[model samples]
Target: MFKIDKRYAKANNQKTIRFTDDLYMQLETIAKYEKISFNELVLQCCRYALENMEPLEKE
Candidate 1:
């Protein structure tokens, strides 16, 4: 079994996601440049998107 970080599991319900090589490489580069773990970079992206998302229209 894989060892998961308890903090990540608790905060985000810990799910796995797959990315294309191009996208993954891009994120990897950005993460390295930012000097953060890949997981931390992903988490930051999720938080930013959620915070900036526009509301849906009413039916």
Candidate 2:
């Protein structure tokens, strides 16, 4: 019997996407070089962007 991990199951339920082979390879390379999973890399990027990205000021 195969029991799905809860975290994976939750992630699987989310609506999003399939990366192309080239992008996957690049993510893998970056992950390996940084000793982090590709998912972690993407999450870190998202967090950083959300924290630092500023919207335009309305005049």
Candidate 3:
């Protein structure tokens, strides 16, 4: 099950990413509703995606 934890450790690294305006608004809205920072939501999403991703078939 995918879950969001409110507590997070301080990040030691930083990254720059770009998002479409529509996607940005959607994420921002969700973060507000979830009472978490947009960054946290994005991090959780990325982590979940990686953990649950299907392995690619050998070509």
- Candidate 3 local lDDT, residue 34: 90
Q: What is the lDDT of residue 37 in candidate 1?
A: 71
lDDT of each: 0.70, 0.60, 0.86
- The alpha-carbon lDDT assigned to residue 45 of candidate 2 equals 55
- Candidate with maximal TM-score: 3
Identify the candidate with maximal lDDT.
Answer: 3
lDDT of 2 by residue, 1-59 (tens): 22212232122334466889998898689767777666666556555667677987899
TM per prediction: 0.70, 0.51, 0.81
Better of 1 and 3 by TM-score: 3
Q: Write the per-residue lDDT of candidate 3 for residues 1-59, one digit (tens) a residue.
A: 98987755355579999999999999999999999999888888888899999988898
Which ten residues in a row are the worst by lDDT in model 1?
A: 1-10
Model 2 ranges with Cα > 4 A deviation = 1-15, 18-23, 56-59
| 36: Cα error in model 1, Å | 0.3
Model 1 off-target regions past 4 Å? 1-12
TM-score of 3: 0.81
